[model samples]
Target: MSAFLSARRLALLATRCPRRTLSTTPRWSADPWPLPHTAQHLSNTQTPSDIPPPTPIPRPGESEETLRARLVYQSRKRGTLESDLLLSTFARDHLGKMDETELKEYDKLLDEPDWDIYYWATEGRSPPERWAKSSVLEKLTIHAKNEGKVVRRMPPL
Candidate 1:
Protein backbone atom coordinates (compact mmCIF):
# COMPACT_ATOMS: atom_id res chain seq x y z
CA MET A 1 0.00 0.00 0.00
CA SER A 2 2.86 2.43 0.74
CA ALA A 3 4.49 1.57 -2.60
CA PHE A 4 1.23 2.23 -4.49
CA LEU A 5 0.84 5.66 -2.78
CA SER A 6 4.44 6.50 -3.57
CA ALA A 7 3.98 5.63 -7.29
CA ARG A 8 0.79 7.72 -7.52
CA ARG A 9 2.49 10.68 -5.94
CA LEU A 10 5.44 10.31 -8.28
CA ALA A 11 3.19 10.31 -11.37
CA LEU A 12 1.38 13.45 -10.20
CA LEU A 13 4.65 15.21 -9.50
CA ALA A 14 6.04 14.20 -12.89
CA THR A 15 3.08 15.70 -14.74
CA ARG A 16 3.16 19.01 -12.87
CA CYS A 17 6.90 19.62 -12.66
CA PRO A 18 7.76 19.08 -16.35
CA ARG A 19 5.21 21.66 -17.47
CA ARG A 20 6.62 24.20 -15.01
CA THR A 21 10.16 23.56 -16.25
CA LEU A 22 9.23 23.78 -19.92
CA SER A 23 7.24 26.96 -19.48
CA THR A 24 10.19 28.65 -17.80
CA THR A 25 12.58 27.93 -20.69
CA PRO A 26 11.27 29.02 -24.06
CA ARG A 27 11.97 26.62 -26.94
CA TRP A 28 13.12 29.41 -29.26
CA SER A 29 16.25 29.81 -27.18
CA ALA A 30 17.52 26.57 -28.73
CA ASP A 31 15.76 26.58 -32.12
CA PRO A 32 17.54 28.48 -34.92
CA TRP A 33 14.49 29.66 -36.83
CA PRO A 34 14.40 33.41 -37.46
CA LEU A 35 11.46 34.23 -35.29
CA PRO A 36 9.97 37.66 -36.03
CA HIS A 37 10.65 40.30 -33.39
CA THR A 38 7.02 41.14 -32.88
CA ALA A 39 4.99 42.19 -29.87
CA GLN A 40 3.53 38.69 -29.43
CA HIS A 41 5.43 37.84 -26.23
CA LEU A 42 4.53 41.18 -24.68
CA SER A 43 0.87 40.24 -24.34
CA ASN A 44 1.83 37.89 -21.50
CA THR A 45 3.80 40.62 -19.71
CA GLN A 46 1.87 43.73 -20.75
CA THR A 47 -1.70 44.79 -21.39
CA PRO A 48 -2.87 43.85 -24.91
CA SER A 49 -3.68 46.67 -27.26
CA ASP A 50 -6.90 46.93 -29.32
CA ILE A 51 -7.24 45.22 -32.64
CA PRO A 52 -5.23 46.93 -35.38
CA PRO A 53 -7.02 49.63 -37.34
CA PRO A 54 -8.40 48.66 -40.73
CA THR A 55 -6.24 49.31 -43.83
CA PRO A 56 -7.67 51.78 -46.30
CA ILE A 57 -8.18 50.56 -49.86
CA PRO A 58 -8.38 52.65 -53.02
CA ARG A 59 -11.80 52.58 -54.63
CA PRO A 60 -12.19 51.85 -58.32
CA GLY A 61 -11.55 55.00 -60.38
CA GLU A 62 -10.65 56.79 -57.20
CA SER A 63 -8.82 60.07 -57.13
CA GLU A 64 -5.02 60.01 -56.86
CA GLU A 65 -5.38 61.36 -53.33
CA THR A 66 -7.40 58.29 -52.38
CA LEU A 67 -4.85 55.91 -53.90
CA ARG A 68 -2.00 57.73 -52.19
CA ALA A 69 -3.76 57.53 -48.86
CA ARG A 70 -4.45 53.81 -49.32
CA LEU A 71 -0.84 53.08 -50.20
CA VAL A 72 0.47 55.10 -47.26
CA TYR A 73 -1.79 53.21 -44.87
CA GLN A 74 -0.72 49.86 -46.28
CA SER A 75 2.96 50.79 -46.09
CA ARG A 76 2.73 51.83 -42.42
CA LYS A 77 0.89 48.70 -41.23
CA ARG A 78 3.22 45.83 -42.12
CA GLY A 79 3.54 42.80 -39.78
CA THR A 80 6.79 44.08 -38.24
CA LEU A 81 7.94 47.60 -37.47
CA GLU A 82 11.09 47.19 -39.54
CA SER A 83 9.11 46.47 -42.67
CA ASP A 84 6.57 49.15 -41.71
CA LEU A 85 9.14 51.91 -41.45
CA LEU A 86 11.04 50.85 -44.55
CA LEU A 87 7.99 50.59 -46.79
CA SER A 88 6.18 53.66 -45.48
CA THR A 89 9.21 55.92 -45.82
CA PHE A 90 9.93 54.65 -49.33
CA ALA A 91 6.32 55.07 -50.43
CA ARG A 92 5.90 58.54 -49.00
CA ASP A 93 9.15 59.68 -50.59
CA HIS A 94 8.78 58.15 -54.07
CA LEU A 95 5.11 57.53 -54.76
CA GLY A 96 4.54 61.13 -55.75
CA LYS A 97 6.88 60.72 -58.72
CA MET A 98 5.39 57.44 -59.94
CA ASP A 99 3.01 57.37 -62.85
CA GLU A 100 -0.16 55.27 -62.78
CA THR A 101 1.54 52.09 -64.05
CA GLU A 102 4.40 52.45 -61.59
CA LEU A 103 1.94 53.08 -58.80
CA LYS A 104 0.10 49.87 -59.76
CA GLU A 105 3.32 47.88 -59.63
CA TYR A 106 4.24 49.32 -56.24
CA ASP A 107 0.78 48.49 -54.94
CA LYS A 108 1.16 44.88 -56.13
CA LEU A 109 4.51 44.60 -54.33
CA LEU A 110 2.75 45.55 -51.09
CA ASP A 111 0.70 42.34 -51.30
CA GLU A 112 3.79 40.19 -50.79
CA PRO A 113 4.24 38.47 -47.40
CA ASP A 114 6.02 40.64 -44.87
CA TRP A 115 8.72 38.05 -44.18
CA ASP A 116 9.71 37.80 -47.84
CA ILE A 117 9.70 41.56 -48.23
CA TYR A 118 11.63 42.05 -45.01
CA TYR A 119 14.22 39.43 -45.94
CA TRP A 120 14.66 40.81 -49.43
CA ALA A 121 14.88 44.41 -48.33
CA THR A 122 17.12 44.18 -45.26
CA GLU A 123 19.30 41.18 -46.13
CA GLY A 124 19.77 41.77 -49.90
CA ARG A 125 18.23 38.39 -50.66
CA SER A 126 16.90 38.47 -54.20
CA PRO A 127 13.16 38.27 -54.50
CA PRO A 128 11.56 35.51 -56.60
CA GLU A 129 12.47 35.51 -60.29
CA ARG A 130 9.08 36.92 -61.19
CA TRP A 131 9.86 40.20 -59.41
CA ALA A 132 13.62 40.17 -59.68
CA LYS A 133 13.69 42.74 -62.47
CA SER A 134 10.94 44.95 -61.09
CA SER A 135 12.04 48.58 -60.91
CA VAL A 136 9.89 49.08 -57.82
CA LEU A 137 11.77 46.33 -56.01
CA GLU A 138 15.06 47.85 -57.15
CA LYS A 139 14.04 51.15 -55.63
CA LEU A 140 12.99 49.32 -52.46
CA THR A 141 16.42 47.70 -52.24
CA ILE A 142 18.04 51.09 -52.38
CA HIS A 143 15.62 52.45 -49.81
CA ALA A 144 16.25 49.53 -47.44
CA LYS A 145 20.02 49.72 -47.76
CA ASN A 146 20.07 53.42 -47.17
CA GLU A 147 17.38 53.77 -44.48
CA GLY A 148 16.67 50.46 -42.72
CA LYS A 149 17.70 50.30 -39.06
CA VAL A 150 18.21 46.52 -38.86
CA VAL A 151 20.07 45.71 -42.05
CA ARG A 152 22.32 42.68 -41.86
CA ARG A 153 24.25 40.52 -44.31
CA MET A 154 22.78 37.08 -43.64
CA PRO A 155 25.51 34.45 -44.00
CA PRO A 156 25.32 32.53 -47.26
CA LEU A 157 22.94 29.59 -46.77
Candidate 2:
Protein backbone atom coordinates (compact mmCIF):
# COMPACT_ATOMS: atom_id res chain seq x y z
CA MET A 1 0.00 0.00 0.00
CA SER A 2 2.87 2.43 0.84
CA ALA A 3 4.62 1.75 -2.50
CA PHE A 4 1.38 2.27 -4.42
CA LEU A 5 0.79 5.66 -2.70
CA SER A 6 4.38 6.81 -3.54
CA ALA A 7 3.84 5.89 -7.21
CA ARG A 8 0.57 7.81 -7.29
CA ARG A 9 2.33 10.93 -5.74
CA LEU A 10 5.13 10.73 -8.38
CA ALA A 11 2.53 10.48 -11.12
CA LEU A 12 0.72 13.56 -9.82
CA LEU A 13 4.00 15.54 -9.68
CA ALA A 14 4.89 14.48 -13.18
CA THR A 15 1.49 15.61 -14.51
CA ARG A 16 1.62 19.00 -12.71
CA CYS A 17 5.19 19.95 -13.77
CA PRO A 18 5.89 20.44 -17.46
CA ARG A 19 9.31 19.29 -18.72
CA ARG A 20 11.44 22.30 -19.77
CA THR A 21 14.04 21.64 -22.46
CA LEU A 22 17.20 23.72 -22.48
CA SER A 23 17.22 25.72 -25.76
CA THR A 24 19.72 28.22 -27.12
CA THR A 25 17.02 29.73 -29.43
CA PRO A 26 14.30 32.08 -28.15
CA ARG A 27 10.93 30.56 -27.21
CA TRP A 28 8.96 33.19 -29.20
CA SER A 29 10.49 31.93 -32.48
CA ALA A 30 8.97 28.54 -31.72
CA ASP A 31 5.48 29.96 -31.13
CA PRO A 32 2.70 28.45 -33.22
CA TRP A 33 1.18 31.90 -34.00
CA PRO A 34 3.23 33.63 -36.66
CA LEU A 35 3.27 37.42 -37.16
CA PRO A 36 1.77 38.79 -40.38
CA HIS A 37 4.38 39.57 -43.07
CA THR A 38 3.45 43.24 -43.31
CA ALA A 39 3.60 43.68 -39.55
CA GLN A 40 6.98 41.98 -39.40
CA HIS A 41 8.31 44.18 -42.21
CA LEU A 42 6.99 47.32 -40.48
CA SER A 43 8.61 46.31 -37.21
CA ASN A 44 11.98 46.02 -38.94
CA THR A 45 11.60 49.24 -40.99
CA GLN A 46 13.50 52.38 -39.97
CA THR A 47 11.53 55.20 -38.35
CA PRO A 48 10.95 58.44 -40.30
CA SER A 49 13.82 60.93 -40.10
CA ASP A 50 13.51 64.45 -38.66
CA ILE A 51 13.89 66.21 -42.04
CA PRO A 52 10.61 66.96 -43.81
CA PRO A 53 10.10 66.16 -47.48
CA PRO A 54 10.23 68.95 -50.05
CA THR A 55 7.05 70.95 -50.62
CA PRO A 56 4.96 69.87 -53.59
CA ILE A 57 4.91 72.15 -56.65
CA PRO A 58 1.65 72.94 -58.39
CA ARG A 59 0.88 70.95 -61.50
CA PRO A 60 1.92 72.68 -64.72
CA GLY A 61 -0.75 74.68 -66.61
CA GLU A 62 -3.31 74.09 -63.87
CA SER A 63 -6.53 76.02 -64.38
CA GLU A 64 -7.40 78.97 -62.09
CA GLU A 65 -10.60 77.21 -60.94
CA THR A 66 -8.64 74.07 -60.07
CA LEU A 67 -6.07 76.16 -58.19
CA ARG A 68 -8.78 77.92 -56.19
CA ALA A 69 -10.47 74.65 -55.33
CA ARG A 70 -7.17 73.11 -54.22
CA LEU A 71 -6.31 76.14 -52.09
CA VAL A 72 -9.75 76.16 -50.48
CA TYR A 73 -9.38 72.47 -49.64
CA GLN A 74 -5.95 73.09 -48.15
CA SER A 75 -7.29 76.02 -46.10
CA ARG A 76 -10.22 74.04 -44.73
CA LYS A 77 -8.04 71.10 -43.78
CA ARG A 78 -5.21 72.83 -41.89
CA GLY A 79 -4.31 70.56 -38.97
CA THR A 80 -5.02 73.10 -36.24
CA LEU A 81 -8.60 74.22 -35.61
CA GLU A 82 -7.75 77.95 -35.35
CA SER A 83 -5.92 78.05 -38.68
CA ASP A 84 -8.60 75.90 -40.30
CA LEU A 85 -11.33 78.39 -39.35
CA LEU A 86 -9.32 81.50 -40.22
CA LEU A 87 -7.84 80.32 -43.49
CA SER A 88 -11.02 78.61 -44.72
CA THR A 89 -13.04 81.78 -44.02
CA PHE A 90 -10.41 83.88 -45.78
CA ALA A 91 -10.38 81.55 -48.75
CA ARG A 92 -14.17 81.56 -49.04
CA ASP A 93 -14.19 85.35 -49.09
CA HIS A 94 -11.13 86.09 -51.22
CA LEU A 95 -9.87 83.12 -53.25
CA GLY A 96 -12.33 83.47 -56.13
CA LYS A 97 -11.25 87.03 -56.87
CA MET A 98 -7.47 86.43 -56.63
CA ASP A 99 -5.39 86.69 -59.81
CA GLU A 100 -2.80 84.07 -60.72
CA THR A 101 0.02 85.83 -58.83
CA GLU A 102 -1.98 86.21 -55.64
CA LEU A 103 -3.14 82.61 -55.86
CA LYS A 104 0.50 81.50 -56.16
CA GLU A 105 1.40 83.60 -53.15
CA TYR A 106 -1.42 82.03 -51.16
CA ASP A 107 -0.12 78.60 -52.18
CA LYS A 108 3.28 79.50 -50.74
CA LEU A 109 1.60 80.65 -47.52
CA LEU A 110 -0.09 77.26 -47.19
CA ASP A 111 3.33 75.60 -47.42
CA GLU A 112 4.36 77.28 -44.15
CA PRO A 113 3.83 75.58 -40.80
CA ASP A 114 0.28 76.00 -39.49
CA TRP A 115 1.27 77.46 -36.11
CA ASP A 116 3.58 80.00 -37.73
CA ILE A 117 0.84 81.07 -40.14
CA TYR A 118 -1.67 81.26 -37.29
CA TYR A 119 0.60 83.47 -35.19
CA TRP A 120 1.36 85.70 -38.15
CA ALA A 121 -2.33 86.02 -39.01
CA THR A 122 -3.35 86.87 -35.44
CA GLU A 123 -0.48 89.37 -34.90
CA GLY A 124 0.59 87.28 -31.91
CA ARG A 125 4.02 87.14 -33.56
CA SER A 126 5.37 89.23 -36.36
CA PRO A 127 6.07 87.33 -39.55
CA PRO A 128 9.71 86.59 -40.30
CA GLU A 129 11.52 88.79 -42.79
CA ARG A 130 10.78 86.43 -45.68
CA TRP A 131 7.03 86.66 -45.09
CA ALA A 132 6.97 90.32 -44.00
CA LYS A 133 6.20 91.62 -47.48
CA SER A 134 3.90 88.80 -48.56
CA SER A 135 0.59 90.19 -49.82
CA VAL A 136 -1.13 86.91 -48.97
CA LEU A 137 0.03 87.16 -45.36
CA GLU A 138 -1.31 90.71 -45.16
CA LYS A 139 -4.68 89.60 -46.51
CA LEU A 140 -4.82 86.67 -44.08
CA THR A 141 -3.99 88.95 -41.14
CA ILE A 142 -6.74 91.35 -42.12
CA HIS A 143 -9.24 88.54 -42.40
CA ALA A 144 -8.14 87.01 -39.09
CA LYS A 145 -8.83 90.35 -37.38
CA ASN A 146 -12.56 89.53 -37.83
CA GLU A 147 -13.31 93.28 -37.82
CA GLY A 148 -17.08 93.15 -37.86
CA LYS A 149 -17.85 89.42 -37.81
CA VAL A 150 -16.85 86.74 -35.35
CA VAL A 151 -15.51 83.61 -37.06
CA ARG A 152 -16.31 80.50 -35.01
CA ARG A 153 -16.21 77.70 -37.61
CA MET A 154 -14.63 76.81 -40.92
CA PRO A 155 -16.75 78.05 -43.83
CA PRO A 156 -18.03 75.34 -46.24
CA LEU A 157 -15.64 74.46 -49.03
Candidate 3:
Protein backbone atom coordinates (compact mmCIF):
# COMPACT_ATOMS: atom_id res chain seq x y z
CA MET A 1 0.00 0.00 0.00
CA SER A 2 2.77 2.47 0.91
CA ALA A 3 4.62 1.84 -2.38
CA PHE A 4 1.39 2.34 -4.41
CA LEU A 5 0.68 5.69 -2.61
CA SER A 6 4.27 6.91 -3.20
CA ALA A 7 3.94 6.02 -6.90
CA ARG A 8 0.66 8.00 -7.19
CA ARG A 9 2.30 11.02 -5.50
CA LEU A 10 5.28 10.84 -7.86
CA ALA A 11 2.99 10.63 -10.89
CA LEU A 12 1.22 13.86 -9.86
CA LEU A 13 4.55 15.59 -9.09
CA ALA A 14 6.06 14.47 -12.39
CA THR A 15 3.27 16.12 -14.41
CA ARG A 16 3.77 19.86 -15.15
CA CYS A 17 0.70 21.23 -13.37
CA PRO A 18 0.41 24.99 -13.20
CA ARG A 19 -1.47 25.06 -9.87
CA ARG A 20 -0.38 23.75 -6.53
CA THR A 21 -0.99 20.01 -6.21
CA LEU A 22 -0.10 19.80 -2.51
CA SER A 23 -2.05 21.86 -0.01
CA THR A 24 -1.42 21.99 3.73
CA THR A 25 -3.48 23.60 6.50
CA PRO A 26 -2.56 27.28 7.27
CA ARG A 27 0.10 27.26 4.50
CA TRP A 28 -0.01 27.15 0.68
CA SER A 29 2.15 24.73 -1.41
CA ALA A 30 2.94 26.91 -4.47
CA ASP A 31 3.67 30.60 -3.80
CA PRO A 32 1.13 33.21 -4.89
CA TRP A 33 1.71 34.70 -8.37
CA PRO A 34 3.49 38.06 -8.40
CA LEU A 35 1.32 41.16 -8.52
CA PRO A 36 -0.08 41.87 -11.98
CA HIS A 37 1.53 44.66 -14.03
CA THR A 38 -1.76 46.59 -14.41
CA ALA A 39 -2.30 46.61 -10.63
CA GLN A 40 -1.88 50.07 -9.19
CA HIS A 41 1.23 50.39 -7.02
CA LEU A 42 0.84 52.29 -3.79
CA SER A 43 3.65 54.33 -2.36
CA ASN A 44 3.37 52.23 0.82
CA THR A 45 4.26 48.54 1.38
CA GLN A 46 1.24 47.67 3.51
CA THR A 47 -0.02 44.09 3.70
CA PRO A 48 -2.01 42.78 0.72
CA SER A 49 -5.27 43.09 2.64
CA ASP A 50 -4.34 46.63 3.65
CA ILE A 51 -3.83 47.68 0.01
CA PRO A 52 -6.40 50.27 -1.06
CA PRO A 53 -8.46 50.04 -4.24
CA PRO A 54 -6.94 51.38 -7.48
CA THR A 55 -6.69 55.17 -7.48
CA PRO A 56 -9.07 57.16 -9.66
CA ILE A 57 -7.53 58.99 -12.62
CA PRO A 58 -7.35 62.70 -11.80
CA ARG A 59 -9.51 65.03 -13.92
CA PRO A 60 -8.01 67.53 -16.38
CA GLY A 61 -8.09 70.39 -13.87
CA GLU A 62 -6.45 68.18 -11.29
CA SER A 63 -3.41 67.54 -13.52
CA GLU A 64 -0.35 69.79 -13.11
CA GLU A 65 1.68 68.79 -16.18
CA THR A 66 -1.13 69.38 -18.68
CA LEU A 67 -1.57 72.88 -17.27
CA ARG A 68 2.12 73.74 -17.67
CA ALA A 69 2.33 72.78 -21.40
CA ARG A 70 2.29 75.96 -23.50
CA LEU A 71 4.03 77.73 -26.42
CA VAL A 72 6.14 80.74 -25.59
CA TYR A 73 7.69 83.39 -27.83
CA GLN A 74 10.29 85.55 -26.07
CA SER A 75 8.38 86.58 -22.89
CA ARG A 76 4.92 86.03 -24.41
CA LYS A 77 2.93 82.87 -23.73
CA ARG A 78 0.80 81.26 -26.48
CA GLY A 79 -1.61 78.76 -24.92
CA THR A 80 -4.31 78.25 -27.55
CA LEU A 81 -5.32 74.76 -28.72
CA GLU A 82 -4.02 75.30 -32.29
CA SER A 83 -0.67 76.55 -31.03
CA ASP A 84 -0.33 73.57 -28.72
CA LEU A 85 -1.21 71.12 -31.50
CA LEU A 86 1.29 72.82 -33.86
CA LEU A 87 4.10 72.72 -31.32
CA SER A 88 3.44 69.04 -30.61
CA THR A 89 3.05 67.83 -34.23
CA PHE A 90 6.01 69.63 -35.83
CA ALA A 91 8.49 69.36 -33.01
CA ARG A 92 6.79 69.48 -29.68
CA ASP A 93 3.26 70.56 -30.85
CA HIS A 94 3.54 73.94 -32.61
CA LEU A 95 3.72 73.01 -36.30
CA GLY A 96 -0.03 73.25 -36.94
CA LYS A 97 0.00 77.04 -37.29
CA MET A 98 1.75 77.25 -40.68
CA ASP A 99 -0.46 78.32 -43.61
CA GLU A 100 -1.85 75.64 -45.97
CA THR A 101 1.09 75.94 -48.36
CA GLU A 102 3.61 76.03 -45.53
CA LEU A 103 2.04 72.95 -43.97
CA LYS A 104 2.07 71.10 -47.33
CA GLU A 105 5.76 71.96 -47.73
CA TYR A 106 6.43 71.10 -44.10
CA ASP A 107 4.78 67.67 -44.59
CA LYS A 108 7.03 66.88 -47.57
CA LEU A 109 10.12 68.21 -45.83
CA LEU A 110 9.43 65.89 -42.88
CA ASP A 111 11.01 63.10 -45.00
CA GLU A 112 14.19 65.05 -45.82
CA PRO A 113 17.63 63.80 -44.69
CA ASP A 114 18.48 67.10 -42.95
CA TRP A 115 16.67 68.02 -39.75
CA ASP A 116 16.43 71.79 -40.47
CA ILE A 117 12.78 71.78 -41.69
CA TYR A 118 11.61 69.86 -38.64
CA TYR A 119 13.64 72.08 -36.37
CA TRP A 120 12.15 75.21 -37.95
CA ALA A 121 8.61 73.77 -38.10
CA THR A 122 8.67 72.87 -34.43
CA GLU A 123 10.59 75.95 -33.29
CA GLY A 124 8.17 78.46 -35.03
CA ARG A 125 11.14 79.92 -36.89
CA SER A 126 11.49 79.39 -40.65
CA PRO A 127 15.20 79.88 -41.44
CA PRO A 128 14.55 83.13 -43.41
CA GLU A 129 12.66 81.14 -46.17
CA ARG A 130 15.53 81.95 -48.51
CA TRP A 131 16.74 80.06 -51.59
CA ALA A 132 19.75 78.87 -49.59
CA LYS A 133 17.43 76.91 -47.26
CA SER A 134 16.88 74.29 -50.05
CA SER A 135 13.10 73.85 -50.15
CA VAL A 136 11.45 70.42 -50.17
CA LEU A 137 11.16 70.52 -53.99
CA GLU A 138 14.89 71.21 -54.25
CA LYS A 139 15.71 68.35 -51.88
CA LEU A 140 13.36 66.04 -53.79
CA THR A 141 15.09 67.07 -57.01
CA ILE A 142 18.42 66.03 -55.53
CA HIS A 143 16.97 62.74 -54.22
CA ALA A 144 15.38 61.82 -57.60
CA LYS A 145 18.67 62.51 -59.40
CA ASN A 146 20.54 60.27 -56.95
CA GLU A 147 18.05 57.46 -57.68
CA GLY A 148 18.32 57.96 -61.48
CA LYS A 149 14.75 59.33 -61.74
CA VAL A 150 13.56 62.62 -63.23
CA VAL A 151 11.32 64.89 -61.05
CA ARG A 152 9.15 67.45 -62.76
CA ARG A 153 9.17 71.01 -61.33
CA MET A 154 6.47 71.96 -58.82
CA PRO A 155 4.95 75.43 -59.17
CA PRO A 156 6.74 77.87 -56.78
CA LEU A 157 5.16 78.16 -53.36
Best by TM-score: 2
Model 3 over residues 1-157: C-alpha lDDT tens digits? 9999999988887786556566556575433543312123111212343444334333344232322232122102223332233323233323334344544443444332232332343332233333236454344333323354333332111
Query: What TM-score would each prediction reach against the true structure?
Result: 0.58, 0.63, 0.19
User: What TM-score quantifies how close candidate 3 is to the native fold?
Assistant: 0.19
lDDT of 2 by residue, 1-157 (tens): 9999999999998899977879998868643543323344323432334545338685899998899999999999988677788888889889988999999889888987776678778876677776899988998888888888774676765
Whichever of 1 and 3 has more lDDT, that candidate is 1
Poorest lDDT segment (10 consecutive residues) of candidate 2: 40-49
Which candidate model has the greater TM-score, 2 or 3? 2
RMSD of each: 12.5, 12.3, 21.0
- Residue 149's C-alpha lDDT in candidate 1? 60
The pairs that clash in candidate 2 are none
Give per-residue lDDT, candidate 2, residue 55: 82
Ranking according to lDDT, highest score first: 2, 1, 3
Best by lDDT: 2
